[model samples]
Target: MRSILIALPLLIAAPAWAQGDDSELWLTATGEVAVADKTSIELESINRFSDDSGGLYEIELAAGVKRSLGDGWYIGGGYVRVVNYSRGTVTRTEDRLRVQGGFSTDAGPFKLSGRLRLERRAASTGDEIGYRLRPNIKAALPLGKSDFRLFAAHESFLPLDDTDWGENAGHDRMRNSIGVSWKASKAISVEGGYLHQYRLPRNGRTSATDHALTFTLGVSL
Candidate 1:
């Protein structure tokens, strides 16, 4: 636990590459099943589009299992695969394994949480290995007498290794988002939000900022 806490800051200080400025749109679908009182299985698929919803650029599929540790603490692990498309051609693919842990607590009329995740990534370019760390915090406010809640979150990712593509050693990406979640039914919920992302370059290029409109549909079974 102490070592994990110490690793968070170190990972943020490592070196990375530039993504030119752009706006994007994202749609995500997610489902979860309870295998036990304290354990659950989760799955998600996401689609990413470029500015003006002009073109499809990326798709991601992920699955994972999570377990409660009691008292608002939890641990989970997952695998993800992402495919990138550009100019009507499949350009790159990334496969990643991730382990994460977090804690949540309630304050008056709100819930707050923090999470830490570590990842091992392999890309199709050369199938090289790289590592990453991500830390984030979230807040939720429930609307009185309604099944709607306001959500806000901020997260940052740091690359930890040098690969054939480039050195992703420093603060690579940051995302700030705000959204509203509506409980449409007992087992279904939807969320819509906007995200602002900032990215730094690894190949000595200019950095970029991306504005994105995001929507998610979640179902629990």
Candidate 2:
């Protein structure tokens, strides 16, 4: 019962050094797939970052990618893999990788689109967390599409490395959410939200600003 850092799975460590301009004008990418008719189907990610002043910021590796597609639907492009056991260890890739294009319209029953993501992370406990970011929002009925919708985010994290494990931790980590989105189509969907955060130990729950949940089951063309 230690879980924090916005809902955990044990990921921390990786981010040799990163300060600014990694490219792609300042990267951003997002990808997902979720299908839950019987469970065991999920994939999700966010990349591109830079937010400072010791609330923490900086992720300087580059390209990240993941995969998993079955009854749940999955895809991979970047943000490789990571786990922060309150500051244990996990790492795969880094530098720059973010994606976003245009148009996915509909607002009556709900369906909207916007994209940009990229991440090269790993830094859960020691430095708090490193962020490679691409900020963009408006997800109403996603992951197979609509079981529930409504979401919002304002992000910035460019923390490549800094570890004393104190001074505002890793700096700048903010998230506000409203939940319930479970789709089993277009690829997949399953989400849980309503988490106001700033954390550092998940899977058991400690505290740093509590009650947060995130789920990912993904796939996209």
Predicted structure with the largest TM-score when compared to the true one: 1
After TM-score superposition, the amount by which residue 44's alpha carbon in candidate 2 deviates from its true location, in angstroms, is: 10
CA lDDT, every model vs. true structure: 0.82, 0.37
> Candidate 2 versus the native: TM-score?
0.25
Clash pairs for candidate 1: 14-169, 14-170, 15-169, 15-170, 16-201, 16-202, 17-201, 17-202, 18-201
Clashes of each: 9, 70
What shift in Å separates residue 24 of candidate 1 from its native position after superposition?
Answer: 1.1
Question: Which stretches of candidate 1 lie above 4 Å from their native place?
Answer: 1-20, 52-54, 201-203
lDDT of 1 by residue, 66-185 (tens): 999999999999999999898567988899999999999999999899999999988888757999999999998886867777788999998988788554688998998877777889
Candidate 2 lDDT at 71 equals 33
Q: Model 1 TM-score?
A: 0.86
Candidate 1 yields a Cα-based lDDT of: 0.82
Q: Residue 15 deviation, candidate 2, in Å?
A: 35
